[model samples]
Target: MIKVGIVGGTGYTGVELLRLLALHPHAKVCAVTSRKEAGMRVDAMYPSLRGYTDVVFSTPEDAGLGECDVVFFATPNGIAMGEARALLDAGVRVIDLAADFRIGNVAEWEAWYGMRHASPELVAEAVYGLPEVNREAICGARLVANPGCYPTAVQLGFLPLIQSDAIALDSLIADCKSGVSGAGRKAEVSSLLAEAGDSFKAYGVAGHRHLPEIRQGLSRVAGEPVGLTFVPHLTPMIRGIHATLYARLVRDVDLQDVFESRYANERFVDVLPAGSHPETRSVRGGNLCRIAVHRPQGGDTVVVLSVIDNLVKGAAGQAVQNMNLMFGFAEDAGLGIVPLQP
Candidate 1:
């Protein structure tokens, strides 16, 4: 079995990781770290994991992560950077489900994240773990940086157009809305039911952190700088992200065909049939990114609608997917979760 250690097993993503790995045929959770909750049974805290995992929460110092075949950092940004180098040097592959090594430029990363990058050298070695764009790189990477939730949906929605030069790169808009769980397992008042429930408002119009991450990915595909206006909103729901992407058509091509062909071989990205509008509920609790492309009035504007469960495809499930690729297992191992419906 592929022994796995998870740092920070207290968040929504961390528990989701445990839930998915429980069904993995080739992997097992060896350690799950939480300094404050050390010695507490993981199942005691997250009752959903009652029978699958009997592993108790261990302090970070006692996790013995270096002995594991791979370690996943489900902690917040910056936590992975501090321990990744040591784990890698010890021959334990690392996958960070945080933004620590996602951005290539160290200065830009520090500026946006408001913290010093602990290991710039490791950042150079870490691959951006977007299987669609960097599958080859992820296979041999000692450290993999999982893409952010908003960035994942936005880039997937815009990729086909940018790669084919079918749309204008000068003006791209991603009007995305994410459920409150995307905010993470925090106790802040803003995340409370009274504040986030029955309420909807855009929070990061001024310039969200995921803006640069998405721009970098799309610009790389377009072979030039892209002018993108990304605005993210907080929806009342508890999961999923719905991104309505707009781009001006610079050339005429079949948008539906383009998307379908681009993701034909991708297991997680579901390019819906022509004239279909994908809904967030269609992808909730699943490791799928369901997208639909549209052109209004057969005009010059091309619109793409993309939906994904913020915690699954956008976080832990994607991390596990990376692990499978890194270890030469089936790409969809432990990630065949069907979307939960009403």
Candidate 2:
């Protein structure tokens, strides 16, 4: 079994890792670290994991992470970089589910995240963990940088268009809406139920942090710098991200066929039938991205709708998918969960 260690066991993503790994046939949770919640049974804090895990939260120093085969950092951005080097030197594979090493340029990451990168050299060595794009790289990577929630949905929506060179590169737009859980499990005035509930408004219109990461991924596919306008919104729900992407078609082609062929082999990306509208709830609690492509009145514009559970495909589930690839397990191992419905 692949022994696993998790850093920061209290947040949404942290418990999410615990919940998913509990079902993994070839993986085991060895340690879970939390400075504040040390000595507390993990199941006590999150009852959803009661019968699944018997591990208790411990301090990082006492976690014995060096002995684990792989360690997942589900903590805040700065925390992972400060400690990843030592773990890597111990020959343990590391997967960071934060923005620590997602961006290729350290200076750019610093400007947006508002902190000096602790391990800039490791940034280059870390593979971006978007399995659809970097599957081969992730397999051999000692350090994996998991993509953010918004980037995951947006990139998947625009990937086929960019790769086929079928869209006007300079005018790409991603209008996204995410549930409140995207804000993380924090006690902030903005995230309070009274504040975020019964409200649907757009934030980060000027420049969201995920903008550059999305641009970087698309630019790499298009082989050139693409102009993109990415705006994110907060919805009243608890999970999922719905990304409505727009790009002008540079040539005439079947939009449905393009998407279907592009994702036919990808088990997690579902291409809905033509003229179908995919709902966020359809992918809730599952590591799946449901997409639908359209052409308005046969115009030059093409629209693609993509939906994913922010905490699942957008975070923990995708991390597990990467671990599966790194360890040569089935890509869907432990992630074969049906979406939760009303």
Candidate 3:
């Protein structure tokens, strides 16, 4: 079995890692670290974990994380960079579910995240862990930087069009909305239920952190710098992200066929039928990204709609997908989670 350790197992993504790893046939949660919740039984803090596993949380200094085959950092953005190097030096592969080692340009990452990178030397070596685009690189990576949630939804929606050169690279727009849970398990005034409920408003219209990451990913696929306007909104729900992407059609091509063919063999990306709209709830609680392509009135504009659980395909689950690839397991191992519904 793949012995695994999770850093910061008290947040939404941390607990999520525990949830999925518990059901994995070839993996075991050897350790989970949380200074605040140290010594607490896993199932006790999150009753949902009841009847699943009985591992107890440990403080990072005492977790003996070097003994594990892999370590997942589900902590805040800066936390992973501080500890990833030590674990990697100990022969433990690291997967950071944060923005620590994602952007290749060190200065750019620091400017946006507002902190100096702890291990800039490893940034170039750290593979951006989007299995759909960096699968081969992840297979041999010592450290994998998991992509941000918004970037995941936006990039997947625009990949086919950009790769085919069917759309104007400079004229791309991604209007995305995510559930409140994407804010993490925090008690901020903005995230309070009474404050965020009954409200639907865009917060990052001027520019979002996900903008650079999305442009970086899409640019790689398009082989050129892409000009994109990415705006993110907070919805009243608890999970999922819905991205409505728009791009001008500069070339004539079958849009639906392009989307379908691009994701044909990709098990996690489901391209819905033509004219069908994908719902955020349809992908909730699962490691699936459902998409649909459209052309209204046969105009020069093409729209792609994509949806995925902000915490699943958007965060913890995708991290697991990368771990599977790095360890030679099926890409979907421990990630064939069915979406939760009413």
Query: What is residue 219's positional error in candidate 1, in angstroms?
Result: 1.0
Candidate 3 lDDT at 24 equals: 98
As for lDDT, the candidate ahead, 2 or 3, is: 2
Q: Rank by lDDT, descending?
A: 2, 1, 3
Q: What local lDDT score does residue 241 receive in model 1, on the 0 to 100 scale?
A: 98
Tell me how candidate 2 scores on lDDT: 0.95
Checking candidate 3 for backbone clashes, the offending pairs are none
lDDT by residue (tens digit), candidate 1, 71-108: 99999888999988888889999999999999998999
Give one digit per residue, the lDDT tens place, for model 2 in 1-342.
989999998999999899999989999999999999999999999999988999999999999999999999999879999999999999999999999999999999999999999899999999999999999999999999999999999999999988888899999999999999999997889999899999999999999999999999999988999999999999999999999999999999888899999999999999999999999989989999999999999999999999999999999999999999999999999999999997
Question: For model 1, what is the C-alpha lDDT against the true structure?
Answer: 0.93
Alpha carbon lDDT at 107, candidate 3? 96
Whole-model Cα lDDT per candidate? 0.93, 0.95, 0.92
